[model samples]
Target: MNMLEVFVSSLEEFQPDLVVLSGLHMMEGQTKEMRQKRLLEAVASISDIPMGVPVHLELASMTDPELMSAIIHQQVFPLVNSVGLNEQELLFLTQAASGPHASLASWNGVPDVGVVSDIVFWILKEHGRTPGKASDLTRIHFHTLAYHLLVTVDGYWANQVAAVAAGARVAGTQACATQTIDASRVFLKAPLEFATSKMEEASTVSLNPHEPVSEWHRDGVTFHYTPVLVCKDPLRTVGLGDAISAEGLLYSEIYPH
Candidate 1:
């Protein structure tokens, strides 16, 4: 059996509470057609568990609007419960939302919280309205260097504050892992006040049109936003978003309403 078959079989046997999918860009094949087929099959095989897909778009994928659209709209968006994207991917999606020829000048630099928030909601709205979308996601997650944002219907997940804390802890773990620090140091030494301060800092920045900084209600959804545990000098930059996404999903499962 191929990788897809093996993965599906394992899911059936183990019955995991959550599954995080990534590395679509790493799938190997001589031709694009071959890889696309595998991706579609893999997406089809996942049905039972709550799945999250991070938009870890490679440089090539970022440059190619057509490929990016196909991967998101055709394969990933339709299969996952939640979607995670970093700042760059979020910008690209914003551009795509505008149209094929939309200018990227507005999103070129470091965007403010309000700008990013608007783009995220636009993407979510587009996904919901897209005809023939095979799946409807319950949550939209956006991770940036400084903070993370979660958008979901009010009452869909209990304890939004705790969920953000869990994600921050996971991000802390990633930073520790990069520094070769003992993982135990995180739980033993990190103070709760530090995380709280970060959240406070993130909340100081007002949303566009003067909305609250951290959490707000709009269109039946409550937005949960929190600052990340940032590492000053990091050994690695890759896979950070994946770690954050996994931790958030696992935390929600363990402490669901």
Candidate 2:
């Protein structure tokens, strides 16, 4: 059987609450047509369960605007309920979509959170409004060294906050994973007090003092975000985004805050 058949068979057997599609560029397809065909089949097989696609652009795809566009418009935007992008991926998407042209220095230095938020919101809105789209996205996640931002509709505050916390923990675990050789030790620890301090700072300064999590409202959606502990020098970076996206989705489904 082909890749799609295997994926479909697994989906049937597992019946998971959420499905994540990542590293499509790393799949066995030598050509775009083959990859997209498999992607369509996998997406079609998923019925009601929420699907997420993280923009894990490889080096080649990152430089190839055409390939990036096809991946976003043809494969990802149409199928996923939520999409996650790291800092670099977020900047690339914003520039590719002709939304903004801010420098990474600006993002990392002074870090205009409002500008970043606006760009992300615009991307999500555009994707949802696209005509003939296969599915409507319910959430957009932006993970950075400094923080994790979740954009979703109103009344999902609890789920969104839970997702933020889960993502933070996953990120911390990934950092720990880099330091050790054992996979079992990855999720064993995290700095709770550090995360709490950052959260308190973000909530006290950027958002309303009454709310536990930092949030902003725009275009009928609420942005729930929390600061994450950044590894000054991570030993491993691969799959960090995937870890964050997966844990975030899982927690949103299971805990709901």
Winner by TM-score: 1
What lDDT score is found at residue 121 in candidate 1? 60
Candidate 2 residues 31-99, lDDT tens each? Answer: 767756765664455443324321122222254445555656764564555677776666766665666
Tens digit of lDDT per residue, candidate 1, span 1-257? 16656776777577666555665655533257876776677666654343432111222125444456666677566555567777777766656556322365544443456566566665555664233644455577677666677776444456556666577666766776643334444332211221212112333333332321267655665677766556655555577777777667665632243
The lDDT values for all models are 0.56, 0.57
Ten-residue stretch with the least lDDT total in model 1: 190-199
lDDT of 1 at 105: 56
Off by over 4 Å in 2: 27-61, 102-111, 129-134, 155-158, 177-212, 254-257
Model 2, position 196, has a per-residue lDDT of 15
Write down the lDDT that model 1 would get: 0.56
RMSD (CA, angstroms), candidate 1: 7.6
**Candidate 2 global lDDT:** 0.57
